[model samples]
Target: MTSLVKVLNENTIYNSEKLSNFIKYLEEKYIIKDEVIFFNQLVNFSQNNSIPLHGWFKYREGYSHTLVREMITRFTIDTKKEFIVDPFCGAGTTLVEAAVNNLDSMGVDVNPMSVAVTNAKTNSYSKADIEEVKLLIEEIPSIDLDQTEIIDYEDIQQYFSEDNFRALLAIKEFVNNISKPSVKELFFSGFLSIIEDSSDRKRDGNGLKKSLSKVTSVIDFYCDKMKLLMADISESSFCNIGKGYFGSATQLDKYVHEFSEEINKKPGLIVFSPPYANSFDYFESYKMELRMGDFIPRLGVKGLSDLRRLAIRSFVSAAKDPIEVDEIIDLMAIEIEEAIPLKETYTGKKDSRTRKVPQMIRGYFHDMGKVLEKCGKVLESGHKCCIVVDQSSYLGKIVPTDLFLAYLGEQVGFNVKEIIICRKAKTSGQQLQKYPYLAESLRESIVVLEKK
Candidate 1:
């Protein structure tokens, strides 16, 4: 009759009795009020098998797999449905978990890189297929090209070595040659994951800095990175399990509408973590992938046109009302105004470009609103949609994301049921804020809405 925690700590095989004791222990220690029994079962299962989507791409800011499992458990108890949808499915965490639970699920993301990663993780693939791809990847011959002509401006060459870059380029060429869409996607994902590692960019460093600036030889950097990536893939060949799509959430409505006629039922749950109001450029962070994929027109240049087009599309389709649109505009304007002084302080003239924050925010919400409207339509009545979001404070003003989402949900004919606060680690800048309240306040909240 050893304690469950002790047994778990000792790495002993858990039986029914030991698992029950663990559930009781969790309830006593953490005050888990709902689905304790289910959670125990899930934890036991997780011990045996790697969590599906959680293993895909390792993002420093990625959501916890444990948290996702808990959310899924809660979702199952609240509704009796078979399908879940994550409109902003970063790395396909939700979809992978849903599939593991034996529920059909759909995930959508605007970032092509994220979509590629998601698709690779969720899609069912045989070990033979993976081995074949691995063999093909190894067969690629490394060829060195003159660094000056091939590498673009703003290219983070430090992230990869010359030899590694040639190896990576060879692999990229082979992946592009693959005929099957599914296999191509898997290869591309693995390629994308290694890009940062292969480059001179310090992959292990904090993301806030331009760590890639220090590296000089891109080819050798990429080669080293890919070799490591290939090793990881070779070791963990069994866990990948989800599919991904390259499209905007705003555009997904049309896709769903077309498919809806074939199916009478709506999704049981729709969960997502959309981009925050903080104005971090997702495109900028993964510019390397866009460069490799040839999605961006030119290397090292920010695609302002692409950004503007996406914003316009999202705004046009997602805005529920004039007020929501206005709110987005106002937020964007503030961000634009704030950027002026920041540009003035920086030595780079390029930093002085007009801040697109205003446009980006407006476009984000407008698209999100449209996505919510579509979700309201596709979600079955009484089913739940949970969004993990955070209020972002910029220039000493707080963006009330939770409040805004609640309002948007009401406009789309859903009732905001609850807002569960989840504490977040404060950034250093936030910690230095003069106002103690601002420094210590909750940043994230799970907004739960029900389609009526």
Candidate 2:
């Protein structure tokens, strides 16, 4: 059998035709359609800018609350099941929406900050709970810096002005003194929410970079956030039946089973946007929050590595090695492996990041395969699992992520319902400059699957 590399060398036409044929096969078999009208505005976090609890913290990778509500209504119309689950509930958009509609929900994420944020948003707050945080905010101005026990973590000091840093420490000290568990979690989340804005560095592409503006008022930001949170809670019309767990999505079956037993209802619908295999690490993006909030106890490279190992291997840093997959996916991974090195030869530079793309692709699918299998088990039969994912491009060769996951779902006891194309995805600027044709291949889609 000829390798894809050899085929690319001897006959470029054959290689292109093979990929095109596979893509066409997947599309025809899956019943895909362009449904941008339904999902164009609902596929991202931009729509949550004004939606009360969701707007308190910005998570660029999360989908909209409107999307979850739409899916819950559309998928559960014929059923009596009133429960929801999000395995990769980044900031808990699905869980929050579920609670607002008086539905029971469960969310799980590997990132502690994500769990913290989700818990704060989904927990029911009594009028006294609201008043407790209000008092904490009132007392923020009078706290003394000298009495605060501030343990400065590594590399955290440079991001803030000295006075702002001390002010933040004072607030953390006050919030820590709050004895009630729920109120403590809520205020701690509020503290974490203001860290990015209070710092001189802002979250950029893969990590943090220095912002143009310097030295934001940490106390001011905290007060405003608390006010907004209080108002949202006061106007909340229903009790919170949502809970977040600090754990990996790969172990979702365990949590889902326990939740089902406790609530006496299996989840009717599952909706989430998993981490994209675009080499972007959430740990790198949330370093400030993790460190300052004491969410991650480990201190150096070893600690960071431990956390990455627990997460789904979607980026080069987290992906350790390649694993065997089905023939359809194996072919796509091999093409990526063959294409990346040729790109290096053309530019006369060995880019380590570009070279690791193949490994990331293999590991990403392997982890997601486990997650989808669990979703099939815990969800009530005949319900829908909606995943919002975007395709990735490497040197103009597109990785059809939606198709790959759809195929994986079939192997794990799910019937592919439809692939809704949300919108065209823009490839990285560097990849587009090198391969102008990539624009036609990249897109974001919602892969809808129903349990068999």
What digit string (tens of lDDT, one per residue) describes model 1 on residues 142-243? 442432233452354444566656556666666778887766776677678666655655433223233444335544444444454455444544342334
For residue 120, give model 1's deviation from the true position in Å. Answer: 1.0
lDDT against the true structure, each candidate: 0.57, 0.79
RMSD of each: 12.1, 4.1
Candidate 2: tens digits of C-alpha lDDT, residues 330-393: 6776787787677788988998897788788888898999999999988667888999898887
Candidate 2 overall Cα lDDT vs. reference? 0.79
Winner by TM-score: 2
